[model samples]
Target chain A: MNRRDFKIISEWIKKESTVLDLGCGDSTLLNYLVASKDINGYGLEKDIEKVQESIKKDISVIQADFNVGLEQYFENNFFDYAIMTQALQENKNPDRIILEMLRVAKEGIVTFPNMGFWKNRFQLGFLGRMPISKSLPNNWFDTPNIHLCTFEDFERLCRDLKIKIIEKKVLNNSYSTNFFLKLFPNLFGEIALYRFEKTN
Target chain B: MENKFDKKSVGIVVPKTAEIKHSLSLDCGKVLEKFSLVFETYGKLNKEKSNAILICHALSGDHHAAGYHSNDDKKPGWWDSCIGPGKPFDTNKFFIVSLNNLGGCMGSTGPNTTNIETGIEYGPDFPIVTVNDWVNSQKLLADFLEIEKWACVVGGSLGGMQALQWAISYPDKIKNSIIVAAAAKLSAQNIAFNEVARQAIITDPEFHDGHYNKFGVIPKRGLSIARMLGHITYLSDDSMRQKFGRDLREGKLHFGYDVDFQVESYLRYQAQAFVDRFDANTYLLMTKALDYFDPAKDHGGELFKAFKNTESKFLVISFTSDWRFSPAKSHEIVKALLKARKNVSYAEIEANQGHDAFLMPIPHYFNVLRNFMENL
Candidate 1:
C-alpha cells in the first residue's frame, strides 16, 4: 500500500530472477514485478478470494500459511528473494519464519511498522495506551500485530543471527527519510524496510 | 443375412448364426478341466488377413460386443459406440472379433454353465482364473477365425486388462494395443470395494452355498446388493454429489427403511435392472478373475519385464475423475511400457464421469481415439 516501499522493492529486484512473495495479498507487488522485470514470480496467499484473484491474473500462487515455515513445499535456495511486506508482525513465529525464508531464498526483504517511532513512544508514555497511527491502526485486541518490533530490535536480532544487511530504508508513509533516518531512524521514521542476505 | 435360434431357457429366438460354441478343456495335465473355447464370427475376412482387431469386453460383458439379434428386442452390443461402420473402429475397414472370457456367464461357459462330469453348474467350484487364462483362450478363438495376428487389440476397464494381457502373452500377434481405464495391479481401495461386494453376495440365505437352484430360488437380493455396492464405486464422489446431493426421493422422509435418497433409488433401479440381464454366478466369477489379475507376477516381480519382449505400439488413455481405476494406475502401465522401450502414448483426459467415463461420450475420449486411429 505504501508507494515508497513498493518503489524501493521494485528497484532492488534483479532482471529475470525467480521471486516469491509470501503473504502476497492480492499479489499486486509480484504482478507488478513480473510485468515490468520479466521475472518469473510466484505468490503465496492464504485467503481463498486472493488465490482466486491471483489465478484470474494468470499468476501461479499456492494458498498456504507462511508462519508454519516453507520447508515442506519448496527446496532449499529455491528462489532469489522472499519478500514480506507489512506481514512480519502477523506471524506466530516471526523469527523462525524469517530464518526459513533465508534458507529458501538467497535474500529476504521484510518491511513492518516501526514500533519505537517517537510519536508512538510519546503517546504510549503520556496516554498510557497503545499508540494508533497511520501504519499501526487497529486496537491491541483486534490487531494482527502480535509480535511487534521496532527498527533497532530487528537490527540487533539480524546481527545476532549473523545476517548481513545489504540495504535499509526508513519511510514516513510514502516519503523516504533523508539523512535523519540514518542518524536516528526509530525516532524519525514510522516504518522500516530491510533487505538482508544470509552471511553463513 | 439373419439366422434365428430358439433358446430354450428364455424361449428367446435369437440369431442362429451368432451361435457361440463352448467346450471343456483339460489343461495342466487334466488337473484343471475348465470351461473354455472359441465363439462364432459375424462378418467376412479381408484378403490380406491383416484387418483383424480383437475386441475384449468389460466386467459382466460377453462375446456380444456388437450387433443385435433379429428375434430378441434387446439393444445392440455394449461398445456399439466405437465398434460399427464408419466409426472410429470402422467395422468396414477392420474385421472385429470379440471373445467371452474363460470365467464369464455367456454362451462360452462360466460358473453358471454346467460341468459335464458333475452334471451341475460349476458355480463357486470354478477354479480361480487369471487374465493370462483369458488371453490364452482368445488364442484358440484367433486360431479358429484364421487370424495369424491382430491389427490391433482394443478394450476398456476389465477389457483393458485383457488387452494388456494380449500384448504381453502373444506380443508378436499384435501390432497395436489400446488399454483404457485399466491398471497393472488393483489398488488397496479397489480390492476393498470388491471385498464388500463379495461379502454381500455370500451372506444371502438364498445363495445356499452357490447352489440356490436346489431351493428353486436365486439370490437376487444379494446380487442386487452386490451390484449396488459395485455401482457406487463406478462413480466419483463429486459426480454423486452433483447428481444426487441430499435430495429426497418422491416423498418426504417417512423415517422407515425404504429408499429415501435419490442416489439410493438410482442404485436400486440399476441393481434391479441389472439382475434381469445378468447372472449372480457370473458376477462372482468375473470379479474373482479381476482380483486374481497381477500382470507383474509372471515376470518375477518387475512389471517392465512383462512387456520387455513386446513389439506392439501402445496407446493408454485414462480419465482424470475415474477414481475406481485412477489415472495413477494408468501411469504405472505407461511408465512400465516406457521403460520397456515400447512406443507408448498416454492421455489422461479430464472428465467428471468417473470410471464409467470410458463408456461415456466425452469429446476428448473420442477425439484422442480418432486421432490415434488415423495416425495408426
Candidate 2:
C-alpha cells in the first residue's frame, strides 16, 4: 500500500529538482520521489542496514547520525528541498537540524506525531497518566518521543528559527484529514506535515 | 572431464591475449608503442551486447578473476564467488570482462616483458603508468572487443580508482560504476605506506636498481618485506585479533624473530607466496600509479568538477574497519557525485575484513551488490 504521507510529500516536490531526505529509513520516500517526481534524491540515514537497503534500491544514501549536524557535508542552498518525516521529537537538537536543513536547501518539509490529538489529551487529562495513544504508543518511561509537542509549540519554534511555514496539513492516525479534523487540528489531528522555507 | 567444481562456477576458463594495435600515450609523457592485454571472459554476451560488465583488478590482481584453469586446479579464480551463474555480477545474465592491465606483470605487457628496442626485460624502463593511462587502455580493449557500452565497470582499492577513472574518462562507455574500498586519490598517509614499500625493494642489494632479472636474482628479502607490509594494511586489528590473537605459533616465545607469533607466520607465508609470483619492478610501477592518481587535479581541484561529465550511475562501497581506504574517503566521492548531480549510491558495510572485505563473500556486502546488479 502507498503510504499516504509519502504520496503527499512526493506531490509537493518539484520535477527534476535535487532533494535530501533526512533520516531516510529504507529510503522508500526518496525512491518514490525519484520514480514519481523524477528528482535526484540523496538520503542520510543512521542505520547501516537501512543504508544497505537504500543502495539495493539504487538510491544514493549516506550512513550518518542525524544528531550530528550536516553543514560540513552540504554547502548553503545545495539542494532544492530537504524533507524529514515523523522524526522531529526523538532528536537531540531538532531546532539545530531545522536550521541546518534551511542552510543546505532552498525549502524543507517536516512531519511529526501531534501531541494535542484528542486521544493523547484523554490519556493525560482523564486517566491522569502520561499521554499514550496510537501515535504515542510507547510508555512514558521508555518512549523515544522525548520532546513531544503540540501544534502551537511547533509553530512558535518554527517562528523562532525564522522558518516561514509555507503550508501546513494535519492528518489523523490513518494519514487522512477530514472536515472536522481540519476544523480542530490541534485537538483532533494525530499527525502534522509542514512545508517551510527561510524567511529571507 | 566430469564437472568437479561447484555448480555455480564458470569452470575451466582460459585467458586470451589481444594485441593492442592502437598506441596509447601515457600520463607520464611516454607512448606505449606496442603492448598486449590478457583478458578472460565469462558468460555469453547477449545479441544486444548490453549486458556486459568490466572487472578491473587492484595492485596485484590479474585477469584470472573467476573459474578454474584445469580440472585439477585447487582454488578457483580470485573472485570466483562473485562471478558465477547465480552470484553477484551473475554470469548467467551478464557477460563479465576481467583483464590484466597494460602495465601489469601477468601475461600482459609490463616490467616482466621484453622491450621492443632493447630486447631485454623492461624492468624499470616500463614507463610509470597512471590510473588515467589504464582507463584509456581499457577503452581500447573495449573497442577491440566491440563492446559499445559496458553495463557496469567494477573494482576494489586501486581497481576502484580505475573504475572511477573509467566513468570520468569514458562516460558513455559505461552504464554503472561500482567502486569498493577506494578513494579518488591517495592520502598523504597512503602515499607514505607505498613509499616505504618502494624503499624496501630498492634497498635490497639484489634489486640491482630495478633490474634483478638481469642477474637472475629476485629481491626476495626486499619484496617479501613490501608484500608483508601490504598484507598488514589489508586486514583490520579486529580481524587480526580474531585470527591470531597473539597466539604463539610454536606455543612459546622464540625471542629471535623466528616467526614466533601466528600472525608473523601468516604474514611470512603470504609474503613468500607473493614474492615468488610478483615482479618487484611491476610492484614499484603499480605503487607509483596509485600515488599519482588524482582525477580532480586537472578539474580545478574539485572532485565534483571531475565527475560533471560522467553519465554513468555510481555505487561506491566501503568497509567499516578498512582504515587503509576508510569509509571517509568513499564519502568524499559520494559528496562530489552528489554535487555533480549524478546518480550515486553509497553503502558502508559493517565489516571487520578491512580493505580486503571487498574480495570476501560477506553476505550483506554480496547482497547489496547482487541487488544493485539485478536492479540494473
TM-score of each: 0.61, 0.97
What fraction of the native alpha-carbon contacts across the interface, defined at 8 angstroms, is recovered by model 2?
Answer: 0.52
- Give model 1's docking category: incorrect
Backbone clashes in model 1, listed as residue pairs:
B3-B16
Which candidate number maximizes TM-score? Answer: 2
In terms of TM-score, how similar is model 1 to the real structure? 0.61
Worst 10 residues of 2 chain B by lDDT: B1-10
**DockQ versus reference, model 1:** 0.02
Q: Could you give the TM-score of chain B for each candidate, in order?
A: 0.89, 0.98
A1-200, model 1: which lDDT tens digit per residue?
A: 55777778888889888887898877788878886687777677666456545544555554456664265356578789999999889888888888988988899999999999988998899988898988999998999999899998999989988889999888886557768777888898888889999896
True contacts kept of 1: 0.00
Off by over 4 Å in 1: A1-200, B1-44, B71-74
Local error of candidate 1 at residue B347 (angstroms): 0.8
